[model samples]
Target: MTEPKAIVSDLESFVAIAKQVIADTRDKKAIPGKLKPYLEQLIRHREWLDERFRQPNPDAFAVYTLHQEPDDSLLIMSAVFLPGQGTPVHDHAVWGLYGVMENQTEDTRYERIDDRSRPDYAELRVVDRRLVRQGEVMISYPPDQDIHRVVNTSDKPTLEIHVYGADLSKLRRRVYDPQTGRVKVIQARVPVN
Candidate 1:
């Protein structure tokens, strides 16, 4: 069996690298493609990524804010999900990158089939369901690839890191009811600790 790798003790460098990448991407005024490389780079930080999963919080999902641009240009956070815990089908208004840091998760991607002008009416179809493992990354942008749900299927707690084009906590996002085909506007909660 291969030996276990040492855990990373310093997260500062990793955060700095992410910040630089986001800044560069913004400077170029590019989205969608620019963040892919950044996500790949983050997934390569195995030790650092694993460090976020060390302690499992039994409360609501554990979320740690790593960095956020003053202008809301970018936001990076580390999220920990306990077993059987997950999110509702939701959409982020801006671009996003999700990277698995520990264990495994089920990511269900959806495609909207109705018009957005009628807020009370909406429809969605499952386009894909993926098993995202450590070192894997997923990208999503509004209008095309933004609606999805993430669930921690492992018995133990799972950790993941996310980078958003805007400060998610301040954005007005949407959550869809798969059965009723209704959409509701909601604000993302700010990460704690």
Candidate 2:
């Protein structure tokens, strides 16, 4: 396991680095893709993540905010998913990166195949499905490549690092039900802490 001190240092260092990258870029939406390599570097070596952010919720997947800018410019969170737990198909309205920090996870990307002219309705097709092992990353930018569902198919628990351009809890996101062609816009899930 990685040393605790170093882990904290790395996290702080990453926040600073991410801020700089965002400031230097003209197109803020490109931040996630630009920071992908840096994020991979942070989680490459699987180690004991902070206990505070690893606590599980028996009823639902858990999310804990590790860092957030006062201006709501950046939000960093840790998510824990128990075996067979996952999220409803949804989209983040902002650009961000999600990295697998512990065990593997199944990420299924969906593409809206319908014209979207119908109100409160949407038809989606699976565009990609893969087992994202530890250290792998997922990226999203609004209105394009922004939809996915993540599940912990493995028997053990899974931990993921999520960094978003906005305070996700404040943004309203769209959730899709492919079977019913239903679409609902709702607030993002609030973090436990």
Candidate 3:
């Protein structure tokens, strides 16, 4: 239905809970049975978070931290995409999950192929493409697993709830050359006064 009021307070709290769940699983070498329900609840919460993104306002791109420790981190990201707003092909190094709140989005996955040249780079070839709709959850892994791009394919707008395993704002995310697959880490720009 709708996102609960409590989940919107801050992103750090959501990250904390997610990190705790991840830690509990790693420390015990397996996910504890008790955490199963919590995981499902988080998934449901993610769905609700996405609902808040169904508008075309950039002001709606509210991101909150769920966790930010050295070992593990989590973030609850809400994004409202206007028509034609899309991301360049890139990779999220850590694991992540996203729930679509409204409308639909298109995701295209690529395969990295090595190319030796003056500048060593990887070539990307589209291997899979999918159209995801409302209430759908997409999960991804790191490295060679899930290099892809996301786009809102609707005339109106779309909303999505994203759960990241790391602090993406602080991390150096890579953007790949769609044709050459050359990898370059994107740095944040500091605005001058």
- Per lDDT, the best of the predicted structures is 2
Write down the lDDT that model 3 would get: 0.58
Between prediction 1 and prediction 2, the one with superior lDDT is 2
Residue 32 CA displacement from its true place in model 2, Å: 0.6
- TM-score winner, 2 or 3: 2
TM-score of each: 0.80, 0.89, 0.68
User: What tens-digit string does per-residue lDDT give for candidate 3 at 23-131?
Assistant: 6555331222323233334544443343333445563223333334665455555666677666778777667677676677898898776643634366778989998
Could you say which candidate leads in TM-score? 2
lDDT of 1 at 114: 78
In angstroms, how far off is 161's CA in candidate 3?
0.7
The local lDDT score (0 to 100) that residue 33 gets in candidate 3 is 33
Q: Residue by residue across 64-182, what tens digits does model 2's lDDT show?
A: 98889998888988899999989888888888898998899999999888897986899899999999999888888888788888889999999888899998778987888878988
Ranked by lDDT, the better of candidates 1 and 3 is: 1
Q: How close is candidate 1 to the true structure, as a TM-score?
A: 0.80
Q: Candidate 1 residues 1-193, lDDT tens each? A: 0221232233565455545656656433345455555565566666664455445577667777777778887777888889987888888888888788678899999999877679766799999998999878888888788889888988977878787878887888888888988777888753221
